[model samples]
Target: MQAKIKKVELRNLAFEDYKQLKNSMVESYPEMADSYWRANDIERLLGIFPEGQLVILVDGKVVGSALSLIVAEKLVDKKHNYSQIIGDYSFSTHNPQGEILYGIDVFIHPNYRGLRLGRRLYDARKELCEQLNLKAIVFAGRIPSYGQYSNKLTPTKYIEKVKSKQLHDPVLSFQLSNDFHVLRIMKNYLAGDEDSKEFAVLLEWNNIYFDESPRLINTEKNVIRLGLIQWQMRSLGNLEALFEQSEFFIDVVSGYTCDFAVFPELFIAPLMADYNHLTEAEAIRELAKHSEPIRKRFQELAISYNINIISGSMPYLENGNLYNVGFLCKRDGTSEMYTKIHVTPNEVQHWGMKGGSEIKTFDTDCGKIGIMICYDVEFPEVSRIMADEGMNILFVPFLTDTQNAYIRVKHCAQARAIENECYVAIAGCVGNLPKVNNMDIQYAQTAVFTPSDFAFPSNGIKAEATPNTEMTLIVDVDLRLLKELHEHGSVRILKDRRTDLYQIKKIEN
Candidate 1:
């Protein structure tokens, strides 16, 4: 589909573009040809809220568009037919001061159906909802394929089939793919939706960043699902190739609705193929040059996939000093970095790396998290300090070259989970990068750990991937469990600490 070669954009809908859009609407839905948008209707939408009307252009022509309006929750909070909500085609329901961004209609030209042009329009609507601090993206979407199965299945049954992939409804399937969930099966929503059999699905995509303080639903998330990659050391041709591989994994996990995705330390070091000619020390410094680009790309992915990413650890050279750093790229398009506080003797002697002293915790949609790089996990003091700061989860991105080293990381991680009474997730690279010097061999087993006691796994391991193989381990950890363990569990580790005798001092430089 030459999509890579095509130039696409989401621009404001203009009065002059109405004719082109009408042709697209008719072609995409000939059954509703009489319901084609009028020039006056387009003008009214623009006059009401110009930015709410958006168009997707491919190569300078409108191929798709999304029409929306800000509406009060009280106005359309209950089920109402299409005519009542859209004010009989005059768009009278649009309220400039409303809190919900209601999607009135979205369509892509028939010729552009499979190109994901509709998603662009939907994504743009979500961005708008976020930008305006709207509560959610609400719409009634047609289940156009329902008519085919109407003789045998009810509207509810048809929706269940579409959701489970047993059947495909052009409109409902596409909407579901965009992260919209069906709230209810609406009946007679659209009077003449013959293809849908006069039924529709009430779908919604909530704005995660909706700020009442911009604060999340509560003080803490109940459960958070994590995906950790047991990465294989591959010889990459370039940084883009490495990012493409990362994208594939992120997309897969996002499909499973993971809240967080963790990559192994030095995952991008595979791109070091271009600099393998240099000395190990020089080659790593050359690799550190990709810090900004790596962070930028990962940020884009976090938003695109709607998953929080602990971008493993990367070579970060700062002020003529080499360091290991990882980024916490939030789904809301923001990022924070955590540096490896304790560098191994091997790193100091061979790569001339320095240790970071600043210890911190990051607040995410899930809860407060702390990042500890490979060797950093071995230092119990760092984890304790973060735990003292109310960290609920700690992520470790390591690059070990031996099974013994991997074991040390695994065991220490479990100890941290128990001692700090928080979840610990560790991921590392496996296989060998034969051509890349100083990083030719790796040994790893990805795993997530929980505090040992009642209400948790007996072995202290929630889930683990097979050793020395490439795969992903997904597990769910309840933050509330950690809280219970802290206050009322068999061991009350966080509450039992003898603060009067000693404390883990975290000094900032």
Candidate 2:
């Protein structure tokens, strides 16, 4: 036997669903009937700002509703009763230019309470708040269970207890869990509230992603999605095999809607096995022969897959000199290269390569970014210079032969993220290629690092792949968080730098 279908949806409030909405609110708040909105009031709300009125449906039944209005941030600064603030239920206080979403009411039917419909309504409201790019959501939240402790504790004391988890008030507890902090305690905020004793808590949830600048463009995104490919080292007979493998990873990451696909440095170096009879320097030089064609092919892959490709560091023969290089193959079919600025001692001794003298950030459709190859990230100055260029993300494509070497790259990359106040994503080659000279062993643990702060991961690592594993790590980092961190983080390392004491500047090559 087949089970019944249950479809749930959230949508703007409608006058036609007033009956269902009324039923849900009436049952959700039996203690606040006198405060319920009337038909003409709902009409006025719809007439003023229909978008802010939202409802959630469970199988075509209205199970929850959230009503809100935009008001100037200053309008909510002082104390005011619910009726006075909402203009006596007429919602005349709504200001289209306002940056705050003042929540008038939110309720879910008792029948659907077990389904956590309140959370659904709140999440929808939060999404709408972000879509409108509002500053925050403010509301007078009811503490229905306050009457139980009214005799023993003051409202402020009770709120403190609830916030500390020493006490539990269903409404306030849910709001606290949803990241809404109690701003203040209000006396006589509502009338005829026996449970709340005519008192309420002013709660607020700020939109950390909020922007003050007027949005002239609608499609711009502050959150960037990245795909890190932890490649395995394997010898191949020809270039076609390597291209096939590269395309496979690109396909997988793109399937998940990644904005950019990144491969580890020298991930294609296994092709060097073809010149095994030659010296290490000679074989790598031969590898440089494929750089131009590989870049063009990767460009095609980027456009075809609809993802930007960071074609990991390669050997480039330019002006009769070898330089390690990487390409940023944008989805628009445009591409640019950032040559590795610091060659490791092994790279210099084994391949007779010189580091590229040029240092700059690359501009993409997403935002400004910098690409550092292996040892370049080990030097704080390289990233510090790029950070000055307003780079949002720093990508490090590295290859390390052992865990110790990988740790140096990893730890330094993390430091760069914190000090620069930018996201740092690093990918590397894993596994081994014993048959390929100078590519005999590999060690890697791919990870995306975020600025160390309250808004980001506690340990600073967002997502990481299993050690020495051939896998893809896809993660999203918000550019807005970096902005907030720079301007208002607990420890503003980027802003607190003692510039007068020391400075980092790029010298012309």
Candidate 3:
């Protein structure tokens, strides 16, 4: 039969033809006979749907038919919209935002059964959806009434077979052949056949493109060793006590055969002593005099140890302005500095500091890395920007004085790892430093955290020094594993991000 396919006009169809279609459905499956026979109710539902969804022919007769509906789902603060070809009526929610659909039903006259009209109708609807740029698409298949008459299997068994790997089943091969994967089994959806269960599969096909070309090669060694030096001062009274502990921390760090060593924020707190007692100008001079010796010692240690050191954030007076910056020192004594981008409220209001507006991802012999000072890791943008720039390791330097704050710091590091799909190594202080003028106050507790499938994992701790004790925490980092994780979806939050829907601005340095 060479009948051409066209849109269905349910309202304009002759009353006799409408009755005949309904009777055919009921006759094909007695279970839905009563519900299918209700022409007035079906018309009422059809009236609410979008026009032109139900497809049929006009050979001066009501013959072939098909239908479709647009569908969507909201995800991760974004809307992922798609379309589906549902037979007969166009289904949709009034708001088009919430989850709901109005299914349009289409029925072809028995005389056109042998023609290829259904294929043409399905293809046309699919083309219309593609033109709309829908992200997700699907189609619902109801077990046709003819399945009830087939003796090869029971209705329940037949539906199960069609829904699960029975794509070759002549009744439902069209959907499977069109690339729909079974999603789930939904029951009791058919009218008048409320007792019967209907199997439904939610198949998904993605249209997003990944075009970035990144080249990464393997080195002879798969892992890199890192050492963390968490330093703190308990009070401003005992300056000698602070230096003594620093010496011990340095000693332990020097002893380690590490590729890199990191010190926590405000690594040396001597300057705060005079700042609290004198004017800003006088305090700056005093702090400068005292911090010089400490920094000279650190540079010497980095050179002697023959290891790269990220001399975490410190109160530095460079060209008159005091900045909280991290110094990246090479084994040859050459160094680069990075100012913290995101500062806490206290640092701004009380300390008279401004946050830096730069993202610095450094290239090193081991691999590309980024450094986040304390609070910066809490913001997704910090690590996200680094990831987008191809930085695979995030070194975090934090001075967490309290236990609760330490926990928050740990969680933030883990979140960064997941968001960036990379590795994170966070070093935080663990011990106390006596006040500059006093001899007895010291605080301690330091730890290191790494990236994990769930969050950042605390795989190793070099040492959590006693309240006044000093120590170095050294651990081997698997750089190869980090790269593998980013490639595989092991810690892949970034993989699920919908970049086309959102925009990210670069933080200017």
Which residues of candidate 2, in runs, are more than 4 Å off? 1-218
Model 3 off-target regions past 4 Å?
Answer: 1-221, 232-248, 274-276, 279-297, 318-320, 431-445, 454-469, 507-509
Error of 3 at 205 (Å): 21
Model 1's alpha-carbon lDDT is 0.88
Task: Arrange candidates by lDDT, descending.
Answer: 2, 1, 3
Best by lDDT: 2
lDDT of 3 by residue, 1-509 (tens): 33654543333233345655565455444545354535553454345433324445555454544433444443211322222222222333322332222223444544566565566555554444444444444434555542444455665566566657553454355556554555443343343432233433334432222112324653334477777775544553555666566556656666766778877777566546656566443554455455555566667777877777787776656666555777777777877778887888766654555677678688765678899898888888767888888787788888765667767777777767656766677766545544433212323354544555532354523234444345566777666555545544343666667788995769454
Candidates' C-alpha lDDT: 0.88, 0.90, 0.56
lDDT of 2 by residue, 275-343 (tens): 899999999999899999899999999999999999998999999999999999999999999899889
Candidate 3, residue 216: CA error in Å?
A: 18
Q: Model 3: which ten-residue window has the lowest total lDDT? A: 75-84
Model 1 alpha-carbon drift over 4 Å, by segment: 1-220
TM-score of 3: 0.51
TM-score of each: 0.58, 0.62, 0.51
| lDDT head-to-head 1 vs 2, winner | 2
TM-score of 2: 0.62
* Residue lDDT tens for model 1, 1-509: 44463687879999999888888788878887476788889999999999999998878877788998888888766879888888898888888878889898899887777778888888889889989989899999998888899999999888898889999988898888887988888888998889888898889988766665545444546789998988988888888888889999899889889999999988988878888789989999999999889999999999999999999988898889899998999999999999998999999988999998798999998989999999989989989999999999999999999999999999999999999999999999999988888887999999999899979989999999999999989898998677667655887777777889977787766
